[model samples]
Target: MPQTPHIAFIGAGNMAQAIIKGMLAAGYPPNKICASGRTQAKLDQLTADTGIHTSIDNLSLCDQADVIVLGVKPHMMGDLVKSIAPAIDPSKHLIVSVAAGILAGSIDSWLGQTTPIVRCMPNTPSLVGKGAAGLFATTGVSSAQKHTASTIMQSVGLALWVETEAHIDAVTAVSGSGPAYYFLMMEAMIAGAEELGLSNDVAQQLVLQTAVGAAQMAQESQQTPAQLRLAVTSPKGTTEQAIDTFNKGDFSQLCSQAMAAAHHRSKELANLYKA
Candidate 1:
């Protein structure tokens, strides 16, 4: 049997901790995982909580890991990659970056080698083990390395690969920023329910449960979301009335416009970071 790859996370922030915890919950060996961060206290706490190794030396962590997961902020990625570049063996180490808006090319350049790289755009939902992530791999990435990257992301939630690196921006628009859009809708629904004479507590409870139920139904049913909507919308029904209002308001078009804005912004941020 193949030995488990040793993975090292370059940062010990919330997202890193979430992934670490998720992997632990999924029965990944704690001894195989390690994390490095700026604060000793935080790293110590993480070690205490997960029984994984922790360090303050990034280069040493990279030396010990077969897969180096960059979990730092985008602005810090360049310096972090460069600092550990000398320690990395492109033939032996696979790079997986979770820093948003940092392109794979930029990471490759920073590493100063033709390293296998997987760029992942994972959302805040990963904190709760319900994230939807989009991954893109560079040309140098092997099939096995891609599987390793996917498995790590999957430990948290849904993980899908995009055809091209540019499609990562689309993923950013849809899933990376997707959670905020849903939260906005929930806020509107809760306010609307309260306006309709429901108490604040009741309105919030009902709106949240409704959102959860709808998502669960969509996941479990084979039917497309559009088909499910049609199934629920009877002629002259209350659902039809609400659907008509949304249509009249051009809700679908508005959603498209909003997502486009997000896509454009994602590109802008990437360019800014690359510059």
Candidate 2:
């Protein structure tokens, strides 16, 4: 087997930690992984838990890593990239940014080098190894580097590449903010069930299970979600009545509008963080 590349995470936050845990679970060597963060205690905890190297010295981490994951906040990305720029060898190092709204070009500019950069939009579910992420790579990235980036993200969940960077915003609208959308629906369902006389605990449990089952069915079945919904909705039945009520309230349109709003906001954030 090929040796795993040295991967370094620049920020040891929840997302970074999730990716690290996922990689470890997937059998990536602990000795090949390292992380750095602002808080010594957190880095100490990560080191203790994962057996990966941890430190507050970001530059040293970059020097030793073949793939550098920029896990800092968007506002901190510029300075962080600049600080480690001197340590990066563009020919050998691949930069993977999980920071939202930070563009690949901006990172390159900050580094003052023609770097191979992969910008990834990974969701919170990544923490649980069920994430969906959209990745966009700059022209400088080699095919091999792209594969490496995809493999790293896939350790946590589903990873797909977008044809253009703009589509990443659409991805953000879909998967990045999508978990909250589902959570909101779950909340509404639980409330409705309680109003219909189900106890809170029962309602919560049933709603969560229903969500899990629905998602699993959608994943495993050959039928599309629409087809599955129609299959479950018999003529003049309870499911049909519920579907009718949702349609009456223009649920589909509302969902579209909400996603569009999220997409627009994603662009706004990108612009806000641009150098």
Candidate 3:
């Protein structure tokens, strides 16, 4: 890997902490990172914890970092971008955003066209170093800048690029919010296990390991998920009985409907910014 350059985070929240931790763990020294937030106390805490420089002003962070990451909430993005626009210089800096529902074009428009911006959708699991992010960049973005952003994002987990903006919404619906859906399923499954007289510890460990192992197996296999399901279901086994119920319940249809709703809402959020 190339030497990790100085990067500044415009927010010192959980998501930013996750990125900072992952980068630090990957051998990026504390001096290469800077964190800025509304509160001095929060910035102070982050500085103490990570040894990175801390600031309350976005402009100050912008002046010092090679990459300036917008880490604030979606709705605050427009104003934040405008505020930091004066500090960005195309020759020396790259801007990357982690605000969901905010587009790269919008950031460029707010910052003046010379600055390159990248919009990314990353999830909460990044806090624990298990994150998946969807990234999209405009033509103005140089290859080196995209790779720099990718380096920061991939520190947590996987990243994929999409040609158009719409794919980021689909990513928000899937990997970004998908973890919550899995957690919900795990909760119910564990409850069902405990009801069958398994101890809480055993139930939790079994379900947790099952989810991890299943994900690993899926990644390593050439088979489709449907094919994997069939491989697990025997002629007269317990798995077959569960599959019969899931099929009867139209699991695929339900999943499609739920994901569609999430995608629609992401678009609505972007429109809200326009409004």
Candidate 3 lDDT by residue in tens digits, 1-275: 12566899998889989999899898888888998999898888888888889988789888888888889988888888888888888878888889988877677788775677788999988988989999998777788888988989998988889889889999999999999999999999999999999999999999999999999888999998778988999999999999889889998899999999999999998877752
RMSDs, each prediction?
1.2, 1.2, 1.9
Task: State the local distance difference test value for candidate 1.
Answer: 0.93
lDDT of 2 by residue, 1-275 (tens): 12478999999999999999999999989999999998998889898899999999988888889999999999999998889989989888999999889988888889998899999999999999999999999998888888889989999999999999999999999999999999999999999999999999999999999999999999999999999999999999999999999999999999999999999999999999887
TM-score of model 1 vs. true structure: 0.97
**Residue pairs in candidate 1 whose N, alpha carbon or C atoms collide under 3 angstroms:** none
Q: Hey, what RMSD does candidate 3 come out at?
A: 1.9
The candidate 3 region of ten consecutive residues with least summed lDDT is: 1-10
Predicted structure 3, TM vs. truth: 0.94
lDDT of 1 at 273: 87
Query: Model 3 misses residue 175 by how many Å?
Result: 0.4
What are the TM-scores, per candidate, against the unseen true structure? Answer: 0.97, 0.98, 0.94
Collision pairs in model 3 = none
lDDT of 2: 0.94
Q: In angstroms, what RMSD does candidate 2 have relative to the true structure?
A: 1.2
Error of 2 at 116 (Å): 0.4
